[model samples]
Target: MALTWIRTHDWDAGTWRNRSACRDTDPELFFPIGATGTALDQISAAKSICAQCTVTRECLEFALATNQEAGVWGATTEEERRKLRKSWLADEQAAAG
Candidate 1:
């Protein structure tokens, strides 16, 4: 037997990527190197940039929809994103039920 699964998202809507405030910043800022204080600072800095982004909502939606497991996105760190995803799933389940 053969089994396969596919993943998809509104890539066309990802036009926001072209305007991302972090686009010109060091990509490393979005990906903290560890759980140390320096890493937390990096995450904070990345999020600050996201705070000023006009496309922040789009960036967040895309990150959530894609279940991004790493890096800062839309002013949220990995742990924060995890919590948001959990809450979002709970909301979806409640709505569906």
Candidate 2:
């Protein structure tokens, strides 16, 4: 049996994107049903679902390995992961500098 890649969706394009891609995401996807409070709330709801998902670990691994810039996944917030990524990039830059 072949493994099926799961996507940690963050937005509309992602929600509707082809499932062929192993890992994919978008940070701007939001639910506009009714009077939505804010993007933050939408992200929070999505994160809650992600937390209970079966493929969360794999999703998180993929997001981190790919150095995803934004989107909610892997028990991490966008700002949190971005800071870590920036530092990693800085280290790499310094090593090459």
Candidate 3:
């Protein structure tokens, strides 16, 4: 099958995005419900879907690289990503010192 391409500001056709399991799923699965608090059921559902995705790590890395502030990516909630960003920044600062 010819690979379906999606618009991304990051990597080009050379990346693994073509193989993403979330490619065919609803786009909203990666974002929060409208104006509603992030419910555990919703997060669990998204994470469960991500758990089986082959490109989960790539997706997470993309979110981190792009500083995505909202939505679920690669089985992680927004808060999780926030903590990861903090940790990554700390590691970078430590390495630079």
> In what order do the candidates fall by TM-score, top score first?
1, 3, 2
The TM-score obtained by model 3 is: 0.70
TM-score of 2: 0.46
Q: Which stretches of model 3 miss by more than 4 angstroms?
A: 1-13, 34-38, 93-97
lDDT of each: 0.75, 0.51, 0.68
TM-score of 1: 0.78
List the RMSD of every prediction in angstroms. Answer: 8.6, 10.0, 8.1
Q: Candidate 2, overall lDDT?
A: 0.51
- List pairs with backbone clashes in candidate 2: 11-29
Give the alpha carbon lDDT tens digit for every residue of 1-97 in model 3.
Answer: 1222222434333557778777788777677664356566667777888888887766776776678888888678788888887765565466558
Q: What would the TM-scores of all predictions be? A: 0.78, 0.46, 0.70
Q: List the residue pairs that clash in candidate 3.
A: none
Q: Given candidate 1, what's the lDDT at residue 75?
A: 80
lDDT minimum window of 10 residues, candidate 3: 1-10
Could you tell me the C-alpha RMSD of candidate 3 in Å? 8.1
lDDT of 1 by residue, 1-97 (tens): 1111112345336478999899999999999988689998998899899988987767776777788889998787778878788766665566568
